[model samples]
Target: MKYVTRTCYLGQISILSVAITLTCVSPNVVSAATPTLGCDDSMKTAFKPDGNTTVLLVKKVKKDDPYPSPSKEQQIFPNRPARFAADLCWVKLLVGPGVPGPTGAPSTSRGIGIEVWLPEKNAWNHRVHALGGGGWANGYEETVVGRMSVGNGNLPAPRIAAEEGAVTATTDSGQQYAGASFAMNPDGTVNVAGWRDWSYRSLYEQAVKTKALATAYYGSPPNYSYFEGGSGGGRQALHVAQNLPEQYDGIVSIRAGASTTSDIAQLYPELLVLRDLGGKAPSREQLEAVSAAAVAACDIVAGQHLGFILDIRRCRYDPTKDAAVLCRSDGGTNGTPTCMTSAQALVMNKVWYGLTIDGSVPDPALDNGWDAPVTGVRIWYGYPRGGYIRSLQGDLTWPEMKSGGPDIIALALGNPKIGTPDFKNATANGEDGWKTLTYAELAAAYQSFRAMQSETGGDPDYNSDLTRLKISGAKLLQVNGLHDPSAWVQGLTEYYDRVMAKMGGPASVQAYYKMFVVPGMSHGYFSGAANPNANPPVPADGQLYRALVDWVEKGVSPDSMVFTSPAPGSESSVYKIYPHPHGPQMSLPACAYPTVATYFSGDIFKAQSYKCR
Candidate 1:
């Protein structure tokens, strides 16, 4: 990693010794050149293909091009039909897989899909941006068509950038939808090449491909490139920063989850145990009550009650201390929803502390005794039940019909190279494989899972080679919601700490990267409110995205990110609401880590009342 002197400055020292210090800066400065390609130019012949890469489409779309109305479920972009008023060149490419990934990984020679939308010369902003997909996403066609459906997955970049004359692109990550495991070979082994693409290679491939297409289409490469996404997308953003930092100048990761394999391996077993608890198992409502109680008891641990705790580490309210409120004489429901039964209380505490049994998971390669519990209902108790069942237990009915889930289980169990019969036999006869599995056996299987995940670049390792990112001076913004259950918030905080340690401690990490912790927000978005997805689940202000752009292009680091929700009874402001659609509007500021947002005084519904302490 080489650092170049960006600007020269001379400063005199006031000390007795006369000495001058020289500082080398490398901040991203945008170029002012305009694109030379015209809307009616011959872009088709200009795009030169890479190995196994086929340029599928290169056509100009008028401002009045007919865009179909998005179905109700895909209505995240309400005004997307006419949003891109400028002439646009839509380019689609099919990059053949055999491309080798990060050193030693399998080659992705299969078909990897990519689409780059570029504005005409008049609308061109001399820049490019990439969109990220959500949970186990196999494709990103929805983004190109202007319909982003994940939790706050709808970024302003595609619409705003295109209208502003910038280019944007997305990839299918080699597979087509949520079930990326479909890329497995027919013999029940991983299609290493396809899996390689799914791991992290597709992003790099897509970026390289898009840049080539942009150069051919616009007569020059972009001045700057950016990437943004939430959840799985956030993980991809981290990958770009970690493995391919030179590709993007700025990156935004919202509620980044750990490796998919890691989450599945750890979370699936916890769910199985929770389900096997029989009647003692707590309901989602009961779990939420425990969380509320925890908030009430621990939120004040930092000296002020802000309805929720910004820093959970500062508060250690024990669930056992509230036994009176949980345990009734007969272990029955206490009538009030706030109380729990004795069995419920015990189970809840176990969840709060996560599974600590001897065989819960394989030990980390670089263990610091940070094997903490996956608490609360959101990550475990409140996750999408169908997703768990479908991904793991082979969609088999629970309690009675247990055997036969998916071969992916073999991968999760640490036997990535197992055959279909071996996979079937592993789960065919017992209580969903849990009954016959011993601690030693489970630990071995988990070890295999981790090894394969790392080889495939799927394991969310604590450290990465960030020297390139730091040296290049790319800006990285990572935001995690404290209450997001799908991905353990603690794990992310721990990862950031590890990055700090690996990179050179707090100051070094803070130079080019910063993390913000949002209070009361869920995995990908705010879930406590009704119709959280009615609008992009993130802050309506899009401050994080704007903040990254400012940092990258203007060298302005945002001090605070203010998040806002629609005022109470204004659910109609964005889209339709269902289920429980009533809650007070909220406005809060998520300060950089270590400095938590504290409620001071005045209007609590406004962010001005909160200060980053």
Candidate 2:
């Protein structure tokens, strides 16, 4: 059959089509069937837009296909028929009968959420395009279609699918709890059922069902499949590439979290330290100032201070050496520019060290100012390291251990004798005395805090069986801002190293994965400097997404990408694209683990000024 190609332009919106034809005898071709509309009798309630609404489209399929039979590995239940759902602005297509629920009853089938963009007219040239990331729950089918629209306005999926002459879908990964943990839960008991359902199984099932639904709906399967996402969504993209390589021709995983479990565990130690150091809850302004000062002090070396610590690798601010700036005690009071106190520094030191009391410090060379000793000056610099400190009132004395609870107030004002020697030292060192408090105690305290803060569960290593991904020949790109204290860039680096190690070594893993470290970007693309006008709304502007698209479609890997703080009320911005580190031979070699960017020549502020080897 001949299909006409058409182009439609609506202001900034442009839809272009290329001519194509389809033969009737193609493998897996299906006759066009009209969509049936009926309310589920069991769920006999009027559909309301108040909560999320899902519409299921079912297509009968002949049994003779090459799709994988449900297996223990795939975790999919037996195949029933082809069924797909149309949610707001997206499609959830599935291929199986249904999986067993927590009660062992046949549960509603779960599948991937693919965005379908159809042109106004039917044509054989229709293709499939995959949209990528924005946290697990943030990116919606509507958001992606809107961005691709001509003038940055929302476009309905049906019109888009028709206009692009394509059917597209995204994977919600089964049970829809945002992250995997929530998806696997069925029981009130820590929601374990949702967690299991959401893992790799949901993703796999969605892929299979999406293809089936497309073929059933369009009378032909998708011509091509693509995957894209950043951060948590990036992790989902990696899952597809690894587990279902054949499901997609091109995969874009930007800033993907390869080892999310480890990342969460790592944050625990830091959180504990902050809690112990009297920094549980500081105002946003206080946190911002503290972060700014740390960036300033650590942005450069003594001779070449860059006024910003874009690259944590080059920062060498030793708390012992630059004591005034690194370990001040002003506590954001009395007009002090710093954000931390000595006690807080000790807590942060403990947190950054993973709460391990082995006394082995992180390599100072790679530590930046992150692992510096806690000092009073550093306390006023940012969020307190150990936790929040409460003001002592009226001859405070230590409360009994059991009665004191986990509150910082008891630690601050309770019996002085019960406290550690470092606490005493902090009180004695004039203003900076609190800096000497040992992090060891705080680390132990987290045992109780962990029990109190959240429910407990067994440590489940999601990456334990990454062999499927490895065999699938998926490529991964991970990027993190060096100055990001939220999920500290070091954690991402560490995760990459661990994944490589598990896969044998860099030689074995290099082809499948790579990581890029952005020097100056903050968490969610916030600004590193203190300028409010310069801060750009993060995860916007498609910087990370563009990088992934380039890598996947063009085979052009990004050694470095550019980032800049937007100028206030101006279209122009100061941007810089950092390059991969160069060796003495001037060869651009990938950075080895545990090392950061170092400047051998030029100005430290410029990315061209240094190399990471």
Q: lDDT tens digits, residues 1-613, model 2?
A: 1121221111121111212121111122355574422223211122121122233432221123322122111121123221212222233333222344443211222433433333222443444545433333222322333212110011222333433445545454443322222321122122232332333444444444444445544555565555555455456665665555655555555445443323323333334444464445433344444444455565445374443454443444333233443334433232344445555444434333443433333443555334543233222012222111111111111211011122221122222333222222112211222223354443344343333222221111233344655664545555555444333455456556667778877667656566666544443343434423223222335454455446655676545553444433322222111111111111112243444556677644344655666
RMSD of each: 10.2, 16.3
Error of 2 at 132 (Å): 5.7
How much lDDT does candidate 2 score? 0.37
lDDT of 1 by residue, 507-608 (tens): 778879898877656554443321222121245535677788888888777665677754434432333322222445567776777577776777655678
Lowest lDDT sum, 10 consecutive residues, model 2, at 7-16
